[model samples]
Target: MSKYLISIIGPTAIGKTALSIKLAQHFNTEIISADSRQFFKEMQIGTAAPTQAELAQAKHHFIHHKSVQDQYNVGAFERDALLCLDELFKNHNIVIMVGGSGLYVDAVTKGLDDFPDVDESIRKTLNQDLETKGLEHLQKQLEMLDPKSYGTIAIDNPHRVIRALEICIGTGKPYSSYLNKKNTNRPFKTITIGLHAERAIIYDRINQRVDMMVEEGLIDEVKALLPYQHLNALNTVGYKELFNYFSGAWTLDFAISEIKKNSRRFAKRQLTWFKKQEEAIWFDYLTPVDAIIKKVHSTINAEN
Candidate 1:
């Protein structure tokens, strides 16, 4: 049988995990998660990791696989995920990878370009700039230096903003210049599938999911990881909001509301990101998941 890497991608709170498990079970294979936030074990509730019973449904990899203190990025995830895929392909003809992270999904399927390592001084200077001049200062500078990156990247995200600027200043090139470079083919076939729902429905789901996380002790979970909030791994939506609240930046109610609002906005961004993918086949959330699994199976069978 020919080896295939099948990816299930969708917006946040759109039931990607549930659908992924069904597909993985149908293929009788393990799943490799591409959601970067789920890598940190300390972030289970907020990250909405699979429950214990769901884990028992099929083998999963890369979910809650790292510490908050550990540094992780797309580059690191690409290497680790490819290595794991190599091992999985030994026995399994089809391997499942699921997540909403667009870049991580792209990295494994289309190899990321070589990035120049930056000096510690780069981050140091960025931090000092963030402290003294503020993120707006860096944002304006990025606009002048790499307007292409500035157009798509999240200007409100300090880490993303800083990293883009770092690459621009360090390499004297636009950070987006390195991405979307056509590359050689991989050994195995890859099929990309996207899940989607109506915008109002998706936003409602996101709100409900945030409420579920709070019931699952998300506030306490965030408190536990507060010491490592500075880690790049914890710079995500749920974690960052709670951190600000703990730091007295806002009331807890306001922070919780912010998480819901930001998550909905994030879902919008995720949809926007997937729409740019020319290769993905999309299914609505109301579709029968098992039927979709059959559709995926036939697609893979034809490719095989």
Candidate 2:
């Protein structure tokens, strides 16, 4: 009678979507996506969001559920995801959650760290700094103020950098100081499944995926969203690089190359974060889906 949350986590382009759909089908359950980039309805191609066909194979929640203009954050996602899980547990004993966004996953599984409410003016000033001084300036400020967060966070993303800097400035403490302080209790048991691969293979896969995205109209997608490129949701790996190209700051080839390089770096950071989950069960990226499902069943049985 116990409910279970089967969480699938890994780096980008590692086939988490495919595996998650299979697992959901096997368990006869629904899926919750934790990828923050894919939440924006306009970022389908660049984010490599689940294709309509893949979505049709399994019921999924939280994909393309919000607009890029929406000011959504991990805190809001935590509240929303927990509510979704509460409703899903009433119908099925098991539900699957999948994505590569480490922070979002931790928010649902562990709980978010509590911080004092910062003044809106602090955030406004940070945004002003970002506009006038550029992201590199803010990033350097964070590196000086909170080196730990600078190393771990998506430093290339302006939104993440600004968020950290705002906390440091607003509270007069290192942003990293607020992490890992809260332990939330949930109703259901959680079983985390991590997918991994060799560094060379992971990099190659990311490069190929980025190339495919370009071939699949990633540039066009970015062009369509040019009007809203200033939004936080648009400040992501695939979109930001192309924005530079559109601005004539870089050649198209260079922009595509940056996307791959940045994506590879993002994957490295993702692996570093997910590997810290000492309780997670990890599998090779190419491992048989049946083997993973069997492991999940055994874990559930053992827990019961």
Candidate 3:
């Protein structure tokens, strides 16, 4: 029999973990989590990492493996996850990897773009502009410099947009121009299965999950990590919304509302991102999960 890697991905709070656990138990194999936030042990509640029961069900790797104080990015994640897979593959041919984080998934399966380095002064200039003139000013600059990126980037998210503009201005090359490169080859075969549902259903689930997170002490989680709020890892959706509240930029109600709104928007973008991959096989989250699992089983059997 041939072995392979099964990657399950979907929007936040769309039941990716439950499905992954089921598959891991079925294959009797370990799971490698690609959740970027869950890697930080300090971010347990906010990241919705696996519970104790799920952890005990199957051996897992990469969950709660880092700290918010550490500077871990996709480059580091790619190195670590591939290394874990290398050792796991020695005994078992099939390993399950699952997460909603698009960049990490792409990094492991397709590899990251060879982004050119920018001078420190370039980022410093942009940071100064952000503080003095605000992100709107830098956003307008990015739109003018790289319209393609401007169309795809989250305008409200200043850091990413500015990063793109910084590269464009510093390297004299459009950010999108570099993205046209090809994917790097991987040693293992990747079978990507995406979970999806109707927009209303997915959005409602996300909102409900946010409300549950609040009831489950999400505010306290953010409070505990406030000292590390400036870290890139803490810049995620759940934490950032509450950070604005802490900074007095918004009221508690407003912050909660923004969390739901941003989370919905993020899920939409996730769907859009995953939809672009022609190889991804999607299944509705509500329908009989066994059907999809059987399909996966058949597909794997055929490939084997």
Candidate 4:
């Protein structure tokens, strides 16, 4: 029998966790999480990690499995996830991978794009610029160096901006040139299932999720993680907004509003990213679980 990996991808709060759990139960296999933010052990309510009951329904890997202090990146996650999948495919013919982080999902299904080794000095210079000149300066620099990336990638993310600038500066070429390369061959076949909804519905879901997180102690979660706010792992949407509030930069109401707005924007970006996936099979977010299961099983049976 040919092994297969079913990837459940969608924007935040679009019922990915619920759907992934249901799918995992149906497949009688475990799940691998590609959601980068949920990997940190400290972030729960803000990252909207699976509830204890949901986790009990399915065995999951890479969720709350790392400390914020650890130097984790997509490269490290790729290596670790592949090893986990190797062990999983040993027993199960079908494994489920789910998350909103498109890059991490791509790393496992396809592979990381190749970029020439950049000079360390370039990164150091960029870091210095970020510290002294501020993020806007670097953002503008990326805009000038790689407008395509500025338009596509999360340019508001300092790490992404610095990465693009480093590559652009090191190779003297636009950073976007290194993206969307040929995927590496994999031992198992992958079936990508994308869940989507109307724009207004998605935004409403995002807003409701943000409110849910807040009521579930998202502020306290951020308060507890305040000491580690400087860490890259904490530089995320919900936590960052709360952190700003904690710092007196914004009121609690404003921070909560910002979280909702940023989450909506993030969802939009996710949709844009997933839309480029030519091989993806999409369904409305409200699609019946039985129907999706039938579709997946039929696809698997046909492939086998």
Candidate 5:
């Protein structure tokens, strides 16, 4: 019997979590989250992580499993996630993986691209530049050095931008040049499902979600994490926007509006990355769960 990994991917607030839980329950399996932002234990409300009720409905792995102070990266996540999948596969032939982070999702489904290790000093210098010159400076550098990566990666993310710049400076090669070079074969087959909607609807959903987060104490959550706002994990959309407001750089209303705008942009980038997966089966955001299940079953049967 071949094992199967049902991967649920889509833009933020696109109902991936709900669909993943439904599929996991139907298959009597567990879920592995690939959302990088949801990994931090302190970032629950802002990340819109699974609620207590939703988590109780299905056994989930990798949610709130690490702290912002930890030095975790996608490479480490790939190794750990594969180990978790190995254990789960022994108990059930099917497992579910869900997230809006394209890089993390690809890390599990396809192996990460190999890059040569550069001197630690290179990263140190990049961090120094980020502190002195700001993320915009580094982003501009990447746009000049590796436009392809700049377009695909989360450009607004300082960690992502710095990672790309370090690679480019360390190896004297475009960061995009190192991607998609590895074709690792895994033990189980992957069944990717992407949920999508019209641009206006997606934007509206994101705006409403942001407003709900604020109502649910997102401001208080950000305030609690103010001490660790410098951590890479805290450099996310929801947190960073509020951080600006706390610094008196922007009004609360303006901060909330920025969060919505940034979130919508993040969703657009997510869609751009996920759409590149030509093998994925896409469905409307409102598609019936039963219909999707039938499609999954047929796909599995046909392959067998």
Candidate 6:
């Protein structure tokens, strides 16, 4: 049997975890999580990481395996996940890669595009602009510099917007110009499966997930990590909202509402990002496990 990487991708709160676990257990293989938010050990409730029972059902990697203080990025994850995959293929012909982080999954399947080294000064200036002039100013700047990226990338994410703006300003080109380059070939074949639901359903699920996170002590988790809230990894949806509450910028209720709203927006961005995966085969969120498993088996056999 040939080595195969089955990637389960979808928006947050879209049931990708359960589906991935089912597929992994069915294949008697392990799972590699590609969700960037769930990478930190300190962030459990906010990132919606799998429960202990979920982890025990099948072996998993890249969940809570890093510290928020560490400088982990997609490039590093690509290297690490590939090394992990190399080891897994030694014993199993099939492995599961699952997450909603489009870049991370693409790094393993198609590889990241190599961009020119951006100057530190450019980044510093952009950060300064973000701090002083607000994200709106930088967003407009990106719109003028790289409208394509401004359209496709998650512009609300300050880090993502800043990264794209820096590349555009430093390279004197649109950031999109550097994407979709020939992918680095991998030894194993990747079959991407996407999950989707009606927009209303996705939003409702996101709202409910945020409520569940709050009930699960996400506020306390943020409070415990208050000292390290300045870290880049901590600048995410759930934590950031609560951090604002701690700073007296927002009330607890307002903060929770923001988390829900931002989470819904994030899910929308995820759907937009995954749509760019041209090879992905999308399934309804409620699609039966047997049907998906059959599809996966056929894909593997066809590839072989």
Best by lDDT: 5
Q: How well is each residue in 95-155 modelled by candidate 4, as lDDT tens digits?
A: 9999999889999999899999988999999999999999899989988988877766766
Off by over 4 Å in 1: 115-124, 143-148, 154-156, 170-173
My TM-score estimates for the predictions, one after another, are: 0.90, 0.95, 0.92, 0.97, 0.97, 0.97
Determine which window of 10 residues in candidate 4 has minimal summed lDDT.
148-157
| Candidates' C-alpha lDDT | 0.86, 0.92, 0.85, 0.91, 0.95, 0.92
Q: lDDT tens digits, residues 107-215, model 6?
A: 9999999888989999999999999999999999999998878767767679999999999999999988998785799999889999999999999999999999889
Query: lDDT value for candidate 6?
Result: 0.92
Model 5 spans > 4 angstroms off? 119-121
What's the C-alpha lDDT at position 121 in model 6?
Answer: 100
The TM-score of predicted model 3 comes to 0.92
Error of 3 at 40 (Å): 1.1
Give lDDT tens digits, candidate 2, residues 1-304.
6999999999998989999999999999999999998898899999999999999999999999999888899999999999999999999999999999999999999999898888889889988998899989998999999998887899988878888888899999998999888988989889999999999999999999998998899989999999998887888899888899999999999999999999999998898788888889999999999999999998888878
lDDT of 1 by residue, 1-304 (tens): 6788888889999989998898888879999999988888888898898888999999999988888877788889988999999999999998999998888888898887666887778878997999899989998999999887676665667888998988888888899887677574788888888888889999999999999999989999999888888777777788889999999999999999999988887787678777878989889987897778778778877866
lDDT of 3 by residue, 1-304 (tens): 6658899988888999998888888888999999887999988777888988889988989999888888787889999999998999899988999988777888888888888898989989888998899888998898898887775555556678777987999899998788737578887888898898889999999889989989999999999888998787787888899999999999999999999998888887777667777888888887577887798888888887
**What lDDT is obtained when candidate 2 is compared to the true structure?**
0.92
18-48, model 5: which lDDT tens digit per residue? 9999999999999999999999999999999
